[model samples]
Target: MRRSVRSPYTIDLGQLHFSLQYNNWPIGYVESTNDNITIHSGENAIQFFGELQSISSESYNALSTVIQNFLTGQTSKIEVLAGPNATSYPLLAAGIVGLSLNVHMPPFSEQLIASLIFKSMSLIPSTNTRNVMLSASITIKINSPLGQQSPLNIQMMNMSVFLLYENDSVGMLSVYQAPVKQL
Candidate 1:
């Protein structure tokens, strides 16, 4: 007579640990436990409700911090590791060890400057003239994650912008005082 047997290997998934980072800066962490985690097999999802203190520093003025707090508060990098119990399975630990992050940006459009020179633009066309004169002002905007809903402030500054085509300087955009805004 032949007997049937089944492998006892199984993973709880709740025994996994996740470390999240934003733009190479550590942000927060999530530890899954049997108590706070529930595995939904039918839905193919794992739900957990718990609290972990943020690991970011308050003194540092890094760009990651600004993006997380003010802008898009999303994890740009993630490191997955096996918990104490899950480490016993070498195969599972080997497969889940790495830093991987996926970010999907939706369609976005915004106007940087209302007018090119703060006035009407005039383009003159001449039959025999090959040289064209061009002047422009530039403004750089750093919008919050909330987009246009953030506060608005405008300031003016001077900067040099060059336009090149085919590795050759086609024109130069010289701005004496260009308006700059920060939110």
Candidate 2:
């Protein structure tokens, strides 16, 4: 007689870390909506909502200048990076769609809380899996007192949800496996 054997399988999820930079230097802490990322195959696209908090006054001023320029029809560029790949994209204030800035008064430790919404600027499909990574760099240029240019950069990194193509048999199987909901 022979005994049957069973093996367990595990899936490893991917993670992404995002931050803002100026001249290659990191700025304040960046926070996003969800801490854990999980993409369902059913989603066509995903949007990231986040806030940059506790930034220095100088950094805040620089960012404000960038936004001012963007609102005036000037294009700001943003740099995005993932692993070994990096790309730059132009951001228009009009494209931002929604924005809110809150400044703290003195004696309370000055801080700036900025709400930002970023849409799907572009997409890159993964060659190995159904996953995709979206990366871009945003550049903001401001004029100095002497009429020189000062540039501030914001970097973004995010991953797309797993693709569930309608023609994919595996995706169909997973869909059927989901528990039915009774109304």
Candidate 3:
């Protein structure tokens, strides 16, 4: 006879909350994966995938601004705080160090249907905060096409920030307005 076992770790997206400008956008679904084999090479990683339906243009605009700021080497970050925690983690430490985004936009629609994909790695020798900071590279994909043209693809790199975790949820925080540089 053979013995079988099941992993005890799991995440419920329903309990997860993601926000921009204090406005919470309802997430339709979330999917995540962990790669244990990569651990041997010192690259143990987990990937999160999700979709947000019926997002307003205003909300999407806010998201676009944040992405643009980070990509331009400006001081930009996204705050993430998991369940019941008052502390929100700021992604991208200082001077663009730990994150990336890929955006996809669909063509011809009354409202914008966007797909965002974020990817990043865990920070080595973690931080001392109550939350854990991950070295992450995120990709936001917008599925909207451009007037009979193909969809748009944008990539941003090097965002350093902390990721707070509580039970099984996560959150992100960043500057809502563009920061003015002082000389």
Candidate 4:
């Protein structure tokens, strides 16, 4: 006779209390609307939404103007505040909050890769030259379930991205946004 192994025991807290702070200002708590920030706990996920003005109306307007100036190439960057009354974070313009995304890229077949390689090799001349040049096209498909369900019309803009580790800059990549049909 074999004895069945038991699963690990676990405890779930029905309700949890926590305080949220933005720019050092206490925004609000989860599932409560004392301030501008509002959070909702679902069966599988927790969602929250808030605006920059929620922290402080004065800071919001000031940051908005600063953002406008920066976008117009007037200012290099907006200032960051980190004092007892600080309410500003760098690169945080007026926008929505609590946005989440799940993106994935599916694998392609080897046949497609072989076809692209042959087409690219056709560009090279069949001569006794050591140096030859060739070019190939690469297709990258990005999928997001939440994005597909969104009803709002979205337009992506060109932006520069910098990868950093431990607050130190590592590398940069320039991204150009374009529209693609969902497949």
Among the numbered candidates, top TM-score falls to 1
Number of the top candidate by lDDT? Answer: 1
Candidate 1 weakest lDDT stretch, 10 residues: 1-10
What are the per-residue Cα lDDT tens digits for candidate 2 across 49-152? 43443267766665565455444545434322222111121132233323322222112111222233343346566899865544433222333321225332
- Least accurate stretch of 10 residues (summed lDDT) in model 2? 81-90
| Model 3 RMSD vs true structure | 24.8
Q: Candidate 1, which segments miss by more than 4 Å at Cα?
A: 1-11, 35-42, 49-90, 103-183
Give per-residue CA lDDT, model 4, range 60-154, as digits (tens): 55545543443344532222222221112222212212322221212221222122122232245448864334333334343332244643333
In candidate 4, residue 91 scores what lDDT?
26
Please give the lDDT score for candidate 1: 0.44
lDDT of every predicted structure (CA atoms): 0.44, 0.34, 0.36, 0.34
Model 2 residue-pair collision total: 10
TM-score of 3: 0.25
Candidate 4 lands at a TM-score of 0.20
Error (Å) of candidate 4 at residue 121 is 14
* Residue pairs in clash, model 4: none
